[model samples]
Target: MSTWLLPESLADILPAEARRIEELRRSLLDLYRTYGFELVAPPLIEYLDSLLSGTGGDLNLRTCKLVDQLSGRTVGVRADMTPQVSRIDAHLLNRAGVTRLCYCGSVLHARPAGLLSDRELLQIGAEIFGHAGFEADIEIIELALASVRRAGVAQARLDLNHPGVPRAIVDSDAALAGASEEVYDLLSTKDVPGLRALQARYPGLRPETTEALTALASLYGGTETIARARRVLPALPALHRALDDLQALVAALPGHEFSVDLADMGSGYGYHSGVVFSIYAQGWHDALVRGGRYDGVGKAFGRARPATGFSLDLRKLSGGLPPAGKAQAIRAPWGADADLVAALRRLRDEGEIVIQMLPGQPQRLDEFTVDRELVLDDGTWKVRAI
Candidate 1:
């Protein structure tokens, strides 16, 4: 057995990486605030039932569960933040009108057998509750696209889809009733062979149903792909409406690139009652951002609210973003005097990163490789760049 005690699929975020992640998060959160999204933080742990109510299919199965020591009741580490935010809006905020909320935190999930998964993920997202209209959807999409640009994700594409198409097809074909989970998985991954096998197994399915499923299996690419898909599955009303909504979104966000994938592009949460999307960057294998409409999730917690939003993985975005600044050393030996401490605080408050000196360290701050040094000389403070 290995002597190391680290949990499977989970790792620590060291200082350099952590700092970059936080800086990106701050930029995104500030952008959210400028767009009128207020910040809110929910507890990291919640009762298992409340947490599970916010997810569906594979997500519910991946949650990490445990017994709360004090309450003696089962609790779960949140697999995502959307549900907790829903609970807050419905139960606490109880605002009569629309409310915009944003959050940044870590969510936990267990690695499933035969699947690639990360146990710990840092998410930053916003939710717009109590609004239901194509305008709202367009605004959310634009905001998500804008945030990705602000985060330095060059050449990002938003792949849009509607669960309604798949849901409608499945409802018309009895064989698809209990098969949504498996079919959706395959569609999202573009697993054509698997989809063909599924089609063969359910041979009694109608031609239109099969055609829609097959179209989804092959549906992925740029704007041209969406036009081709429209031809392949011509009779789908739900698909048509979804496409129209997406077209409106694209028009609203002129100059930004996007595409529509008819496939079940993976649902955001148990509450996502409408359009869903995943964002892809040039170098990343998976989406850097994912979100959609969760029209009824708030109602499950006790109110009827129509809302939508997207969450970005800060760490993932860092991987795609260009390096910000060169690594600079931090000064030390901040002196034992109160005035010296005040000087250090001023630098820190001014947004400069400061490192305090350990005992018996070098007295001359210039001995280090820092970009700048804050020092006290004759009861006055001086800052000099190296």
Candidate 2:
């Protein structure tokens, strides 16, 4: 194999895409700051147990594990930062009131999430801990919407779901209670045939369970899907409460396009305990953002806090955006003269991209446009348009 050959789902980010991703990181992180979210940068790797704490089996499969040199213990390259941040909230800060935290970093997934997805992603997100109110959920969703909007995304649609809804129905039956993972797979993919076959696979499976699972698959559509769920699904208390939570979320955010999918047991970390959501826009093939309330995410760390947040892959977000324009620059001749050096420093300090040319050197720039030249105009260096 060629030494330069990269992994199947991993590739180098060229200058153009790298620039756009950096710009977006600055913009979105600043947006989180405006909302009082403190920025945090967790380590790239940690002990497997600490890294995967609170998050369940879903993350374990995605995480890349290796034996650590120092301790000889299993360590995982994080595929998600939310759990690490939860550890910080529970163990480090030990705060009493609401704590809003935000982070942006590269996460390595063992495999690509989809046919065209990358194994490495620049994950950026914000989380609010210590608040269980719907207000927190609303803030996270609105911030998620604002992030794409700030990036100039248009016609973005929001899809809402409560894991509790599907979880309630699954937990109601013995056959499904032990087979939740397989059942979740069928529901998430809308495999109605597989769901129907559950009865034949498990003798004495209730007809009501099969019918409810089938109906949940079609229970995705406009906001009306919530009301339809109430009328069609069984009147389990847990199911009703889940429906009520969805109703509250919809009522809280008026004038936004929303579709409810009752069958989706969130595919991420699997710690979602309440309202969950995803953001979909026209340019992306799948959801651009995913997050929800994972109230007890910190419980494993000895502190339980109500949490809600959303995250998007900056690389994915950048891919869908229009190509960024070339950054403007000023071309300068190579000189060590005191005045010339002073002028160069001044221009650079003033946020100008100044490229100093070497004698007989070829101009090489792919990400910048040099439209101005710095010349020694009658002794004093000055910049003039080319």
Best by TM-score: 2
Candidate 2 lDDT, tens digit per residue, 219-306? 9999999999999999999999989999999999988889888887755678889999999899899899999999888988999999
**Whole-model Cα lDDT of every candidate shown, in order:** 0.76, 0.91
Q: What is the C-alpha lDDT profile of model 1 across 1-386, one tens digit per residue?
A: 67666877777776556778888888889999998999999889899888877567676776788999999999988878998888899999999888999999998777632344457888899989988876677778878888888877787888887777666666767877678778778877788778778767887767677667777777766767656766776566776776666666666766767777767556464457787778888977677788898887876688868889899778767766665454555474646788778878787788776777778765443323477766666768777676
TM-score of each: 0.86, 0.98
lDDT of 2: 0.91
- Clashes (backbone N, CA, C under 3 Å), per candidate, total 0, 0
Top-scoring candidate (lDDT): 2
Q: Score candidate 1 by lDDT.
A: 0.76
Give the clashing pairs for model 2.
none
Scanning candidate 2 in windows of ten residues, the lowest lDDT window is 262-271
